[model samples]
Structures are given as C-alpha cells and as structure tokens.
Target: MQKPRLIASDIDGTLLDPFEQITVRTAAMIRRVIAADTPFVLVSGRPPRWIPPVADMAGLDGYAVCANGAIVYDIAAARVLSVHGLDALVLHDVVHALARVLPGIKVATERAEPGPDSAGAPFATEPGYRNPWGDAESNVRPRAEVLGHTATKLLVRHEKMTSEEMSLAATELLGDAVDVTFSTNRGLIEISAPGVTKARGLAEVAELVGVARDAIVAFGDMPNDIEMLRWAGHGVAMANAHAEVLAAADEVTAPNSQDGVAMVLERWF
Candidate 1:
C-alpha cells in the first residue's frame, strides 16, 4: 500500500488511552511520523481551548480540526485559523425545534470567544442541563439566553434518549439545515452549522498542506467521527469504536488502550 502523506486521528477515544494520556509508544510513533515529513492533525469534537494540551502530549504543534469541524486551530501559535460557526438566529430556530420534538431536552452553546487567547466563559448551558463532566468553565442561564447568540457548537441532552437517538431525531427534524453527531455514548448530541464536520475541517487542512484525500489515513472511534473516517482514503476505526463508526470505517485497528492509532500508522510510517 502507498504510504499516506497525512495522518488524521480523533483524540478522546482513538488517540488517548483509557487514562486519557498518550502512551510512550504512541508519542514516539507520532514524532517518528512527523520526522518523516508526515503531517499529523488531531481532528476532534473538542473545542479549540481543549486541543493544545493534547497536542503537547503527542509532542506536536501543527494544526487541529476542532469542534467537530467548526474550528481550525493552529496549535503552536495559539490562533484560530478559521471558524464555521452556527449563526445566532439559526441556533435559536434549531433549539426551539429540538425542544419541541424532544421534550425535556436541555441545551448548551459553545461560543468561540474573540481574540487569540481562549479566555472567558464560552460555554453556556440552560437550566436543568446536567453536565456529565462537571466542567467548571460552564455558566448556567435560561434556555432562551443560552440560544440567543452564535456559537461554535450546540450541545443537547435528553435524559430519556441515548446520544444516538437524539442524533437521529435531530437529523430528521433539522435535515440539511445543520450537521448532527455525537462524540460520546452519553445522552448528548453535538450540532454544528450545515456541512460542518470533521471531514470538512480536515479537507480544509488537507488543501492547506497539499495532500489529497487518497493519500490521507484517518482514525476515529465515535459516531461524530464517521464522516471523517469515510472521507479519508483510509478510514480506520478502533476496536472499541461505536457500532456505527465500525461499520463506516474501511478497517479496524486496536483499541485506544492498545494505542490503536500508532498500530495503524506504524504500518505506513
């Protein structure tokens, strides 16, 4: 097989181990790939603020496709190259529609604060929104207030529905107006602007680096990563990936705990 010119991998459950740390072997492989002139971009549903540390862990400081394809971040420079955010009016419309369809749903918006440094409370959740991660950076407000402005991503949760169910319902109701996908198995769904996805984000980076889709190898392990996995020339799903993700992938590698990404890259790098 021809070696890939670029390597893109999801962070949480694909690159990081169960402990949420990059293992020595994996880091070594990442550095080796870069040393060989291969660009490794971290494509994830995580916001830009959360990408730098992970990039540091992997000993890389290039570009990262963040917020499920909503933002392109430059790691070393700590700058956001671009953002395809959800407009305020559109967010309000989507939230209202979702609330009607999925009763008892809660909403949150992730706004990309202006300026280079990602300061301030960019995450706002509506009342009754249960934060699964107990994030301290979140601010609680009324539902209307939460959806009253533009955002990088809109997060919705329903106590009675799994992430998959919410994603399906949102996709059905919203159609092409927005992109719906979930990164975790928890009862939460991440919504972005129409056509915003990790695939789209990675494509932008690929064009910047002059790598074609046929020469890119991507790795992921969640439903949010399905589009990216399918968009790359080689889509590799981790062994522990969601069923939907596994089905979408061109091949399966070891689980995150076993350094799935490194396993696949070693073959080419």
Candidate 2:
C-alpha cells in the first residue's frame, strides 16, 4: 500500500488493547507517524468528552471525529469544529417509533454545545437507563425532557433485545430518518442524523486538510466503522472486529490485543 497522507483510527476496540490501554509500542508507532508529518485523526463513536483521555494516552494533540461522526472536535484546543446533529423533533419521532417496535426501550442523548468548552455539554439519559460505560455525569431526566432538544447522537437500548436486533429494528423502522449502527456487542444502538458517519466526518476533515480519500488509511473494529473502512483508500480491520466490519475492510490485521494498528503501520510508515 502507498504511504498514507493521513491516518484515521477508531478508539475503543481498534487502537486500545483488551485492557483499554495503549501499549508503548503502539504509542511509539503513532508518534512516529506524526513525526513524519502525517495527520492522525481519532474517529470514534464516543462523545467529545470521552476523547481527551484516549488522546492523552496516545500523545495525540490533533482532531477527532466524535459521536460516530456527528461531531468534529479539536483535542488540544478543546473546541468543537463542527456538528451535524439530530433535531429534537426527529429524535422524538425516533423514540416513539422505537417504542412501538420494541417495548420498554430506554433512550439517551448526547449534545455538545458548539465552541471551546464542549466538555461540559449535557449528556442526558432517561430514568432506568443503564449506561454500560458508567457515566456518572449524565443528567438523569424524564424521557420527554431529554428528547426535547437537538443532540449529536441518540442511544437506545432494549431490555430483551440484542444490539444486532435493535439495529435491524431501527433500520427497518427509521429508514432515511436517521443512521443506525452499534459500536458495542451489548444491547445499545447509536443513532445519528442521516448521512452522518465516521466517513462523512473524516471526509470533511480530509477536505479541510487538502487530503483525498485515497491518501488516507483508516482502522476500526465494529459495525459503526463499516462506512469508514469502505471510504478510506485502504481500510484495515482488526482481527477481532465485528463480522461485517471484517468483510468491509480491504485487509485484516492482528487483533487490537496484539497491537494490530501498530502492526499494520510498521509495514508502511
């Protein structure tokens, strides 16, 4: 493969190991890439606030595509460059739609206020909502109030359905209204505005930096990463990636536990 002009990677299961830590070797390789003047962008399903620690660990001080591509953030600057969010009305429609398809669905919303201090933006979840990641800062509000405002992304989970099942139900029910995908193996499904995806966010950044799609190499490990993998000039999927993600990638590398990202980068940069 040709030398990448820019490197874009997912955070949770692609760049971090099984323990959610960036190994010395991986960090060193990432720093090496930056030293060679290539822009390394963190593309993730995580909200903006969740990106800082990961960036700090990898020693990255650049841009990130957050909220599964609904947001573009500058890490070191602590500013939101742009946002493609879901309107409150659309979110309300989605919630009602899902409730009809799958009873007892819980909803959460992520809305990052635009500008330098998005870290304090509200993350609202309804009562009885179970945040698997243990987010204590989220405002536990009534579902009506939570769905009354625009959001960068919407998270919905069912008490009895799997993530895959939720994805299918949302896709068939909310087609063209929202983009549905899941980053975790659990029951939660993430929803974004139509056409908002890691690929869309990365494309916006590539245009800003004067890099073409063919000059970028992206790595990921989940269904949410599928569009990005297919969009990049060369897409590498970690061996431990979801089945659809593996099929979407151009090449498969070692799992994240084995430093898969670094393994692939070593051969090129």
Candidate 3:
C-alpha cells in the first residue's frame, strides 16, 4: 500500500497513555510525521474545551474532532469550523425522556464558546444539572434550563450502571434521533448528533487538508473509533483495543503503554 499522507488517531485508549499524556517516543514520532508533511489530527470523544492543550502538547496545528464528531475545531484559529448538533427540540425530548426512564443519571452538556480572557484558555464549556432518582426532595432544575442551546453531545454517568447498560438504555430511548457510544471503559455514555462519527470528522479534515481518504492512516481502540479505523487507508488497532476494533483494522500495534502510536509511525513514516 502507498504511504499515508495524513494520520488521525483517537485520544483516550489509543494515542494517550493511561495517564492521558503523550510519551516521548510518541511525541518524536508525531514530529517525524509532521516533518514529513503528514498532518496528524486528534479525533476524540472529548469536548472542544479539552482539545487545545493536547494539541499544544503534541505541537499539532491541525483540526480536532471533538464531542465524537459533533464539532470540528481549528486549533490554530481557535474557532469551530463545523458543528453537527442535536436539534434543540430533539435534545430536550431526548434528555427528558432519558431522565424519566433512567433516574439518577448525571447529564452533562458541552458547547462552543469564546476562549478565556487569560492566556492558554480552554475552548468551550460544560455546564449542566445533576438529578438523582427517587429523590422527590431534590431541587434540580429542568433539563431545558440546564441546556440553553444546541447540545453538541450529552454524557450520562451512573455509578451503579455499566457503560454497556447505559449505552443500551440510551439507544432504546433515543433510537434514531442520536448516536450513542462509550468513550471510556468506565461507566460513561457518549451521545452525539445523528450521523456524526469519528470517520465523518476525519473525512472533513481530509477535505480541508486536500488529502485523499486513502492517504490517511487512523488508529483507535474502542467501539466509537471503529468507523474511523475502517475509513482510513491504513487502519491500526492498538493491542489493547476491543475485539471489534481489532477486527476492523488493517493491522494491530502495541498498547498505548508501549507507545503503540509511536511504533506505527516509526515503521511507516
């Protein structure tokens, strides 16, 4: 196969180690890829608020896929180039419906906003409410009051519930109105705008950079990354990746602890 001219990777459970930091080997390999004129984009389920720091640390100036592709951010410009958000009406209905069915769930919403006045600001913000089930004495606000605009994504966290269980519950509740997946091994569910996926975000980045999808190499380790891994010309699955992710990739590299991303770049670049 021809060498890739672009590289996109998921952050948690893929490129970043368990501590959520890039290793020296990974940083060096990223530098090598950039020096070769191959741009690497960080595609994550994280909100835009948490992407810039990671980009700065990696010395990347490209786009970032945040909120599981609901938003595409330009790191250098500090702006959002594209956003696929859930319709306000749909979001309200979904949130309310989910709450009614799954009580005690914690709902978190992420949205784009101006950077902080201080230097090195984090883009976007997360402001929402928490409501526990069977707590009639609680004074939690309504879901509408908590969500003011189009919600880029909704995060549901429940300590007693498993990620898979929450995901299944969300799917059953939202159905075709949204896309739901697990962003972490812990019990957290990520909800994205319908039709938004990591693969879609990477495609937009490829178009913006004038690179063919076939010239992109992607790496991932979770179910949310399956589409991206399959979309790239060279799909790499981390050794610690889930079985589905491993099966969808063209190859498997070492785990993040072993600098899997660096290992791939060292050989390919």
Candidate with the greatest TM-score versus the true structure: 2
Q: Model 2: per-residue lDDT, tens digit, 61-180?
A: 989999999998988888889999999999999999899988999999999757654454468999988877776777888999899888999999776778999999889988878899
lDDT digits (tens) for residues 160-262 of candidate 1: 8899888989999999999999988688999999999999999999999999999999999998899998999999999999999999999999999998889
Q: What is the TM-score of each predicted model, taking all chains together?
A: 0.96, 0.97, 0.87
**Candidate 2 segments whose C-alpha is farther than 4 A from its true place:** 115-121
Clashes of 3: 1
**Which is the better candidate, 1 or 3, if ranked by lDDT?**
1
For model 3 the local lDDT of residue 122 reads 24
| Pairs in steric clash, model 2 | none
Sort by lDDT, top down from the best = 2, 1, 3
- The TM-score that candidate 1 achieves is 0.96
lDDT of residue 11 for candidate 3: 90
